[model samples]
Target: MNTITANQLKTRGVSIIQDNLLKDQELVITVRGKEKFVVMDMKHYNYLRECELDAALHQAKADYQSENYITETVDAHIKRIKQ
Candidate 1:
């Protein structure tokens, strides 16, 4: 991870960010002495999103395997929600 001030980003523009991202670097942007933002390449961002989805799916599978879920039909679910 690399840290850059908000002012530096404003001065250098998004091109500097693109250059760093080519090396698989992530940026942490700070403003007013506090961490404010993150910059990452789209490929890495998509990979992370996929990882999160996979994790959720795995947890759901585990829960189902352990009989830890409730079973309901769509109509029943809608009726309950309408109440």
Candidate 2:
């Protein structure tokens, strides 16, 4: 992680993105000396998105188990969907 002031990031934004995007490096942008935002590579961003989705699915499964919800077999679920 690297810190860049908001003004410096705005002024030299393109060069900074070009240098860091491929390396999966992140730039922490600050405002009034307080951390405000982060800029990261697309790959890392997508990876984070996937992680969030997985966590949500895991939580859903746990909730279903705790509630004793019945789950149909894969073939039965597919047949019902096709109907």
Candidate with top lDDT is 1
Q: After superposition, how far is residue 59 of candidate 2 from its true place, in Å?
A: 0.5
lDDT of 2 by residue, 1-83 (tens): 77778887789877876676556567777998999998887887999899999999999999887995657999998998899
Write out the backbone clash pairs for model 1: none
Residue runs of model 2 more than 4 Å from their true location after superposition: 21-24, 68-83
Which whole-number lDDT from 0 to 100 does residue 13 have in model 1? 95
- Which lDDT tens digits does candidate 1 get at residues 1-83? 77778898899999778776776558888998799999997788999999999999999999999999877999998998899
At residue 83, candidate 2 shows an lDDT of: 100
**Candidate No. with top TM-score:** 1
Q: For candidate 2, give the lDDT of residue 54.
A: 100
Residue 23: error of model 2 in Å?
5.4
Off by over 4 Å in 1: 73-83
